[model samples]
Target: MWSAEDVARDSVRRQGDGLPLTAVGERVAEAAVREQEAAERALVGGTFSEYEAEPERVAGIWAAKHVEWRRVRDLMAQCSWSRYEPDRDVQGSEWARSRAERRQAVLSGHAADLVRRQDERDELRAELWLSAGPSRLIRVAADRADLRPVEVLAQLAERVVVGEDGRVSVPPFSPSR
Candidate 1:
């Protein structure tokens, strides 16, 4: 069976956005709702535990996923509720509106942090996920330019076909078939 670390790494790759979206409770609640929706969409497995055997790894991955969902939920909530209706502006109301906008701007920055955090988590998840499953050698991007392909590929099998096997093959989900 694949380990939780593998799954966690795969998810990490998807999240490039920063994090720490915790703010007012109402926003938190709305965020939670959004999170549930996203999680529902993401459910290939019944629960994250389906990905791993170890209890601690499962817990860590779940907690990480939860944080990611919560951040997304709050970001959506902020976008939906931040603006006021047009054409109803008194001096006092205008001032309040401006204040609210400022608050949201600051909050948006916070949301960005949360997004970034999610990305961080995504990075971890992506790695874990990749390790747990099979992979094809797509393309290699290395920091050092002079090194030949052999340095990265290391094995003769990595040249053509990808996945756990050395032979060329297509992914099951690929639509070419």
Candidate 2:
């Protein structure tokens, strides 16, 4: 029986493993945008074939860019600060208030970026899982927020075989497998 803490830890591990892919995706999108922009510039300067043959490639680049942008937007939404204000009568001293405001400003500036990066990484992992799914069960399992890791494993699996000794088996499965 997997505890909630085990599930949470596994989720974190999975997210961490996929973090590098997010950076790679970001770089790929940036390079694609630069290439597209250069090609557009060449077209504007009277080069006919510069942008003629790569419409499909350009479309893919833009699609990836859009997906990444949407991920960032969703991350920002998740990180939105609560609309709570301190009571005027119970407010602390001016020095303390100033320090708090400074701390908040720093956090909003720096911590928000870190949160966005983390969110993007998680989104990338989810995207990869979704892309690998032809299975409706996996799709539905991926969407579930309340599932334990073991439950999620069972849900996404094609077949779950349990032995008489209570050990469960999940075969190696992927789109190509």
Candidate 3:
């Protein structure tokens, strides 16, 4: 079982990001924002084509999912520990054995959930390298409260210069120039 201090530390580290809140999630979100900003700068400065920018946008989606996965993992660990520890002390009782069996089933389900989350995380990570240029890489779900991948790409698109040759580029200088 997790100690009170462990739980407390986790809560404080979360810094107001809500339920299943995790410190890792907060850090990932910050990093994603920084990367997104860098990608935007590159796009506006003609340093990055839309093809190059797609991964940066997909990164935000990856960050959000990463956080969610870690949260699920943390919860699963605590639940498994709590279930096992009490049963350990009362091992000889028939009631304890029955309860342990039920708990084991639940823990097995939670373990499966953890595996699924890990698979999702890995898929998102793979997307960073496999994305096809000029095509959207990820679909943002409505429930997500993290960085808006589509909006970020759309903002960059507004500054793109498309020529008659069908090539997309940025102006040599900002309109102010």
Candidate 4:
């Protein structure tokens, strides 16, 4: 089983491994949707609990949520910097100081709006991470195979449980509280 913290660390590793953060997030979201649908199908057929017992499904759900959080977090960072770009460019131009002042005022208002958007994005990203769960059921349907080893490791930093004696146990799947 993979814990939320593990998933977050894996996302950072993936970001460092050269895959664009947004792309990784998108992929995870897509996979989550797919797995959710599969779980739903199993539920309809009355075999959902059995499916949920698979460790891979739990790992996948954790990974998907983590990646999504990272992606949105990164986007907020980009917005913060990009929003100031125009203002910087305008300031560096040869326009008269008076004209620059007027433009700067307008840009300042735009920057405020950008800040609000960033805040909203941050809230949504937090919600996504905090509310992370596999929709429908806890299982992966038969429509797809298990996640790749690299993908799993990228999303899960460590085993869910490591005892003082170094005994590791895979945690059972459970719905998010």
Candidate 5:
């Protein structure tokens, strides 16, 4: 798909390094692109192929899978404590006025508030897991995703025995029961 202009632009750059195309390099590059396209068609064309996946469909699948992984990361981010709240750490409740410092925007204030709430939520979730244990935690997370908890337990199951149906067999609460 290289245009004549693309060929010329690239060839000029390559030539600047003392490798100018005599009379054939541009043609060779163009022919290589064309040949590759032709091979793609032959490999997946009118002959023996039962189906072909469209690029857009493939891209959509990739995007959805990416979003699923991102959801996992975002869930984990709720627990992130790598840094203190930006303004609170820097200025406390009172504003630190400087000749050049602008007032905090409304949206930024809301985002900080949201992060604070999420930190509290994450703490509660961690406590819930510690009390109910891993099976319950995986079940809650998987239920949120609308997938069976077993799918998630499969991803994190360690001590508990997981059945095909996702039931986890934890031993009876020890003497503490």
Candidate 6:
């Protein structure tokens, strides 16, 4: 059984454009999604009790709520009067009303906390994506300098300066010939 930490980390790693992962990263990401899907199924079956404390279970619950949210949102988006709540047999303005009610129910209760956490996670992920560029640069530069990436990054941190005029002053790269 994949742990919650594994799912969360792999899920975050799978995000972002142009950030290619190693083969292992790819495998882990695929496994994480599969775990989430299994959790979702368990949630539907009321068999998720054993994993209630797991963060991955929460994420899976959020995923399930998201599916419902989308369906309700789509119903609200439709302009047709022919649209009806198939399950509730609601029609006309009542259909829209029913959708709104269902949307609130789907987004409320524990799901509201999940939404907040998801928002914070998204903000952090954005920051991580922004840093990925510089991290990649550090890796390439470190490789060329025959030094560890952390050493290269630390040297830059200590020596690289930003001027008031917005010019960057990097210590001269004197690669051994």
Cα lDDT of model 2 by residue, 10-88, tens digit: 3222332323435434544664675477556545554337547344444444444444333433443454513211231
TM-score quality measure for candidate 2: 0.20
Per-residue accuracy of model 4 over 130-176 as CA lDDT, tens digit each = 22244212223211325443333323334468889998776643222
- Candidate 1 residue 89 C-alpha distance from true site, Å: 7.7
Each candidate structure's TM-score, on Cα atoms with residue i matched to residue i, is 0.23, 0.20, 0.20, 0.26, 0.17, 0.21
- Comparing 4 and 5 by TM-score, which wins? 4
Model 1, 1-177: lDDT tens per residue? 233333432342234223233433344454456446545545533344455333444455555545544444444456563422222223324444565676688899999999999899865221222332232232232224333433333323333456676667633321110
RMSD of 6: 22.5
Segments of candidate 1 deviating more than 4 angstroms: 1-90, 124-177
- For residue 23, model 3's alpha carbon misses the true position, in angstroms, by 48
Q: After superposition, how far is residue 102 of candidate 6 from its true place, in Å?
A: 79
- Model 6 misses residue 156 by how many Å? 0.9
Sort all candidates by lDDT, best to worst.
6, 4, 2, 3, 1, 5
Please give the lDDT score for candidate 3: 0.45
Model 5: CA > 4 A from native: 1-52, 79-177
Q: Best candidate, lDDT-wise?
A: 6
At residue 15, give the lDDT of candidate 6: 34
- Poorest lDDT segment (10 consecutive residues) of candidate 3: 83-92
Give the Å shift of residue 59 in candidate 3: 49
**Residue by residue across 33-152, what tens digits does model 5's lDDT show?**
544554565556453233264433333333333333332233334545232232322222122232113324645777999999999886523222344676776667777767676555
Which regions of candidate 3 deviate over 4 angstroms?
1-92, 125-177
What are the lDDT figures for the candidates, one per model? 0.43, 0.46, 0.45, 0.46, 0.42, 0.51
> Where's the lowest-lDDT run of ten residues in candidate 4?
135-144
lDDT of 6 by residue, 85-122 (tens): 33332332354455557557866856979988889886
